[model samples]
Target chain A: MTAKTTDRDRDWAAALAAANAGDARAYARFLHAVMPVLRGVIRARGRSFGPDQQEDILQEVLLAIHAKRHTWDPAAPVAPWLYAIARYKVVDAFRRRGAAVHLPIEDFAEGLAAPEADPTAARDSAALIGQLDPRSAEIVRAVSLAGESTAEVGARMEMSEGAVRVALHRAIQRMARFAKGERG
Target chain B: MRTEDLIAELAASGPAAPALTPRGTGLRMLAAVALAAGLFLMLAGTRADLAARLAEPLILTKTLLPAMLAAIALPLGLRMMRPGARIGRAALWFALPASLAVLLWAATFARTAPAVRFADVTAFALSECVGLIIAIAALPMVFALRLMRAGAATRPRLAGALTGLGIAGLAATGYSLFCTQDNPLFYLTWYGAAIAAVSAAAAALGARWLAF
Candidate 1:
């Protein structure tokens, strides 16, 4: 290989190694290094979602690159592994935020309701809810348990009813997220 | 390969996310099932008539205590699951409403004079304050999952919601056992299901503004 090409390759190798070693500074370089590819995949996915969402997708990927660094197999090529994650994250973001997408939320809803009827769904359902805010946790109860109107509930709780509605809506969506044991 | 072909080749060659250790998955699933089991205890307990039951055990004041516990512990449990990110913390701060807002809403809705009762309002506000802090601490977990990169099934939104549900669900179940005992169906039909449903809804909405 030419001297420039060899040096560039060595630089990437060192960057990847430092990232794997838990070096935050090096990881930032790693994130910067991967940005072009990340943006490319995002842009390739299309600009249908507003620029903000598209940017969000990229940000999500960068954060993922940071958080899941340990999961990378040192033996594997980094580019494609990252590319897939970026792609999946963007698609998920689109589905999640009601962003511009080729498919609509209805399609997602249909799939989501595929029925988490494993009988054990309830048991599997609880811990996930623990991850949200307590008031949100309360809102989940108010709307679901008390059957209070969202507006009344929100007002009583001192929040916008619409915000309450949205919070409950997302919580349900999250709970209904019973996987078909596919992620194994 | 051409750029597109090269990219496609790269994509095709990517490996699956590293498997969470069997122990880790077991821990996660165990936590889920354990929570579910704990919740069932509480859930079944709430099936009694809370009013009549209240007569038996000072139920009115203490029955809802489990619910309160669920509110606090639930968020703490959720926060433990987060991967730690700046935006995640920010999201937690934004999630809790000001205590004044709750007072205003209560005044507007209740027939009681808005100006009169000091103790009850103070108590409620204090609990609200406590609840909000607990939530703030735990709230970050939900967003942290989001801020961290996702893998196979650990969608940040899903993770956050489930953690919240698991923590809150069991506690709510326990609360129902205590408070709604006389009216088990009351809590089940209302509170238990309501929180779960609403939490899921919030997670869904979260997919919007909380993106990336």
Candidate 2:
């Protein structure tokens, strides 16, 4: 079990390192790999939450991880950092809903072995995206939901690919901020 | 949105800018200190005896104490910026300088004649001393908060308080050069009050601004 955990950590760390070095495909793989762990952890700790609420927390955690990616240290194991962020967001969600719970670090280890569950569409994130300006919202929808490339989205929108990418990035950041209750 | 779709979008967002290193944090802090020092010098010129006063223990303590606190707080604040980072014994390290300040104050309080002790505590520009420290710290506090915002501080209030403590230390250190009050009682009261005020303000601000 220890060896398996070590191997998982090594792979996740390597993928995240690659992602930091600008490998998009590796980044996608890393995110996909961590999703189950995050979902399990959230579900375990947030038992009071309904499935939709759990997923909302999951999505918020994912957005936070993306926005704060620079806080991760490549030299350190990814698990602690990943679990810390997940725990923080989970605790935050609970706090916002006016409840308190304890989540020991041991729970994260158990979360690793949790059964994989399909993700449902989350409402909060969708609402945040809807709150974004029209152009940014359209670009985000095209790129993520439609799975279109930046180049494709840009061509359709009559903007440069770089412009599309920047818009999308800013939109994601704005959504994260909105999730945290920031205005403008 | 589906988690899978969200992951696809995040992955497509491209690589983040490089993670900030301890060295980078140090450099930015240094820049903020240098700017604050420049402002301090311009507004309140250094005392003429500044060179000679360095040899005096009390005069030196005034500067060294805050400098020590700043040194401790800079790294502590930085560590708090990372997610899941345990503060451990680092939090305890603050006691060293704090104890030193209290010791110095006690020693001076004991030696001074009772008739002069009260006068000593209130002898100088009490409001100005605190006002100057806060003013000096204003820019650095903003800079520190910006740096904290760039990182992911889970304990935003504590992190903000640390930043305030660190910036106040640096500001007080710079202020000591221009401040002519040498009484340990006066410096300790006003300087301590000023640092506390800055830290409290930072704590309040951090609770709001440092979220996420």
Candidate 3:
């Protein structure tokens, strides 16, 4: 949209158009020209990521550009299309990392003191489990509430680890419904 | 893994790639359309009324209209093969002939009573005519898509649809040779539907195969 963007698009479009016509050197030049632009775009978009993650995103955008090179329309502005691909790669990286909730340790330092476990909370968890099928309830208690590994729960229940995990997931869902005062 | 290495690899791989051009691709599409027409004529001879209909402006318009559509669409399809390229609003020009055909059909309908119009529109060979045109378009559709894949079609679905429209229009033009029905209403309804069908099918195929 800006004059700067228009210039970049025009440059890229011309370079890529030449590249598609079997000009290897032009293709290299196009790639070289795009690399820094893509890196900057990725860095700005994924500011939450570290240097390594940003590099990974940059590489992803590069690979995507390579794989989808033939999909670019030579007559259109190249920068917007290239940046759109970069944005998608960044989003994919974010999705792959899931979500991280960060807090400064300085603010939580006073709260780090050990506190007594609440019996009512434990009792409430138990009551929630009591609403599930007996087998599922036990799996949830072991794998979730009791902090037992899935392998340990599986071994104790004589079920495959995957089966135990599945049962536990269902039990947790039912427990969530119960907590929300909804019938599961 | 490094950007320089990636660029070097891409550059190195370039020699094996053929030098492609929009003009060359456009010519190939024309060849495909011609081939489809040749095959259709060889397989299904011209209609019994063809010699007589050749002199009629209205009958000649049926084939000419589609030929015009194909001519317009060919360049548009070629344009779509490149990344960043778009089939401009100029493509709307194709609709002109189609609109005229519809108008001509309306005029015919008014002149000819409802019963005669119904008889012409519901001709027994209607489905077969549509099917034959679609069948003729199939091979050209493949050729067009292959040509398109060789280029960078950023909007694959649109590119494919345009290819289909262009190729199918040509195929319909060829089918017009064997079709005895001279009524614009029949051509508008059946030919229009057949072109739409081919375009839709091409769009679907392009979405799956053409997208990177």
Candidate 4:
């Protein structure tokens, strides 16, 4: 099924149809009209592709459209079909390079998952735990903020592993309630 | 090359494209088939006992099955010559007549004694028939390839192979007229091989020559 055509798309279709009918000027105009938009399509895939790669893909799309111009259905809108070829060429270039540029999961994790020692978060945690008694605050900070194992916190606090885990769970539940209360 | 230069070069040509007439292509293909048939008749001649063989259904099927394959494949090959047009699942219909021919071959083998089956498949015409069909196919294949070049084929190799199949079918039909073998097995094996050989050769050539 075809999408609704815009005035811009109709202009392209008319030019291409005219070009098919032996109008050289119209064919040149059609090529000129599409080049910028085709460049934009390739550019919009982001900077993972270098300038040379983008140019290569753009030339490929233009060549394909030119070579296969007769195959385009004159009744259909031109823009989508042309962009589809550009997209395919871009993808082909990416595949040919063996690997695509991608931001790794760790990059996003660093951006979104605030580190334990983030100053603002650490201050907030300190304020929240300040409400606790000295022993509870020490246990919460060692096990949660400081990223210590339960057994290590247990040994440091002179308690069993099970006891340390219970205390850590209660500390998290209390911190959650306190935060929700502060938000409310 | 720069897009501007490419555009200028393409537009500089007298016409954007030739008047692609599918009917004209179909006629040329038929003419090529006829020419190949005439050549085959001149070289190998038609089978003797022509009236008696025509009376037999199996013999008639052996002679005409390859023609049926051509009838089916020719239209598809012409359609595929157009860029962006696909053979699609509809091309699978080519196998229907082919499968029927294979079934006939199976029945022939089942009904005949093993010793006779061996003799029938190994007849003097067995190998010669393949050679004759390929010989007859050469002209039609060239015609089909030239016709293919007139259209912009996206998948040149596939289009070339399809044209080869159609042309080979026509060639096999011509060869069948001269092929005297009564056993379906011989026609099925040798004819199928000749068509495949042509298709493979055309596909290889198309890869090098058919792209727009």
Compare the candidates by DockQ and give the number of the best one: 2
Q: In candidate 1, what are the lDDT values of residues B25-122, reduced to their tens digit?
A: 32453355345445545544434455565675334433443344344434443333322211345335323322322443354346445454332334
Better of 3 and 4 by DockQ: 3
Error of 4 at A179 (Å): 64
Q: Give the CAPRI rating of model 1.
A: incorrect
Over B71-177, each residue of candidate 2 has an lDDT whose tens digit, in order, gives 89878888888888777888899999989988989998999988877584443487779988999898788777877788788888988888889889889999999
Candidate 3 vs. true structure, TM-score: 0.66
Ranking by TM-score: 2, 4, 3, 1
Docking class of 3: incorrect
Select the stronger candidate by lDDT from 1 and 4. 4
In candidate 4, what are the lDDT values of residues B2-75, reduced to their tens digit? 55776687666655665466668888988987898887798777888777877898878876787888887778
Model 4: colliding residue pairs: none
Q: Estimate how well candidate 1 is docked, as a DockQ score.
A: 0.02
Interface RMSD of candidate 3?
A: 4.1
TM-score of chain B taken alone, every candidate: 0.32, 0.93, 0.91, 0.90
lDDT of 2 by residue, A102-157 (tens): 12112323444552431212444467678999999898677655557677788999
Give the Å shift of residue B68 in candidate 3.
1.9
